[model samples]
Target: MSNCCSSSSCETTHPKKHRCPANGSEYSEVSARTIAHHIRDALRWRPTANRYFFCDDPACDVVYFGDDGSTILKSQLRTRVGVKELSNDELLCYCFGITRGDFIANPANRDFVMAQTKARLCSCDTSNPSGRCCLKDFAKPEM
Candidate 1:
């Protein structure tokens, strides 16, 4: 037995339907293989700025490197956001003007994990919930 397919001459006979998007952009599902082929084009470099999140929270902003334990997300770019090798803590300190303590206080901002970095999230001073009061930004003494 042989199978048969038909060529259509009318819109009503078409097997698929497409709708115009209000956003003026057309979207359709693409096969995984087709997407993988464009990996190089998708992964291109762009301009960047200095490290760290612009955190205003006092606790999060002024974190330093520790000799023990892992490399946490502090004093660096937003690691969560690709193209930037920083952490949320850095943003709190530099970009947005927040501190590590205050930034950590807000649980929602805890976006990504940091390891093998200079700064990372540390235990907040339980006695003083407001990291602003506990953590102060002081210039490191010249060594």
Candidate 2:
């Protein structure tokens, strides 16, 4: 992990693992492959040989922050971070392209996703910003 925060833009407190620079929320660690999938082409070259964390805080602009204090803002991502979006149209299942609205309109979507997941067809690790199973987001399907 590159803990070297020599840049002036570096806003994180060094040595602290997985903290969002914008909101200070404890973030979830994500792999470079996950970063590469979500980050836009312009910022694809930004991922260095360092540890990256995903900030699920909807209020925070920093989506991915490195241990070195480097950050990739939400606007830098190719897809909308579902947890960060307030609209019902926000995507919920990346692997199946199911939106929050769809999930709410049909509870069966969740079951479908669960079935697909059980069948090993889901790819949340590279599709979702959190790099976690979408089923967790389904805990409270109320829109």
Candidate 3:
């Protein structure tokens, strides 16, 4: 997938103001066309009509929104969906059955895990409880 904001036009244009549907947090706009195809497909976005808005609030469930005032997609909405606020002991790499504790135990293993993920060898998109790639989640520093 392409970088989240690699397009020149996206860089030059000012982001439109919007609010998160989940938490009413304000955010800058991002064109749906500029986001990765997989993300767009997963969100089922209509590029022409819906402008994308990203929310960084961890407590908020809605991550992306449409300019039409619709919630296009969400993350960390429910535990059943496999999106949860992970604790230190919780598993981090569902595809390979790796946990945060496992990574702490063997920090060197991170590289191997990342390589497998990058190669798409790990079935995170399907197997992961969140129904999304684990790499981005893993990359975040533990809180």
Candidate 4:
């Protein structure tokens, strides 16, 4: 799938404004379209025969499956999907897109992991002064 913002024009007139989907939390999937896009994004990386990433936004609290396969394979992702310890093994895992399961050595995969993490951290929050959110904590976590 193309990037979440790809031709999405999910953008709004007010840069900080985030459209909340009626289905769930303002930070999570605001609509079916958002969910679909994320699922597609997850599917784009699954190299195995039938592996998938599961995304449940803390904002929305609604669990949706990034089904690279027919069904939601939580068992597989939680059980089989892992940080590929073996050398030169093609794999993929979803740690909310922060960690890449593909050996953690492949340059392209490294970029992908970084991008995902960045995207997740991208401002989608509506609680900020700008009515948007961010993954990174500008403030100290300990404070």
TM-score of each: 0.15, 0.81, 0.46, 0.21
Q: Which residue pairs does candidate 3 place in steric collision?
A: none
Worst 10 residues of 3 by lDDT: 75-84
Residue 1 of candidate 3: its Cα lDDT?
Answer: 29
Clash number by candidate, in order: 39, 0, 0, 3
Best by the TM-score measure: 2
Clashing residue pairs, candidate 4?
A: 21-30, 125-132, 125-133
Query: How do these models rank on TM-score, best leading?
Result: 2, 3, 4, 1
Candidate 1: tens digits of C-alpha lDDT, residues 1-143: 12223434343533222221222222222222322222233244221311111222223332211222111232332222111223434333332334444455653333321221125344222111212221232111110
Query: What are the per-residue Cα lDDT tens digits for candidate 3 across 22-102?
Result: 788787665554344325344654454456665656566665566777764443222222224455566667778777767
lDDT of 4 by residue, 1-143 (tens): 35646665655532322223323222322233323333334454434322222233322322333222233332333222222222223223334332222333443554544575567743322112111232222111321
Q: What residue runs in model 1 are displaced by over 4 Å at the alpha carbon?
A: 1-5, 9-30, 40-143
Flag regions of model 4 displaced more than 4 Å. 1-78, 84-87, 90-92, 95-106, 121-143
The true-structure Cα RMSD of candidate 1 reads 22.4
Off by over 4 Å in 3: 1-19, 25-57, 61-83, 129-132
- Name the top lDDT candidate: 2
| Residue 37 shift from truth in candidate 3, angstroms | 17
Which one wins by TM-score: 1 or 4? Answer: 4
- What TM-score number comes out for model 1? 0.15
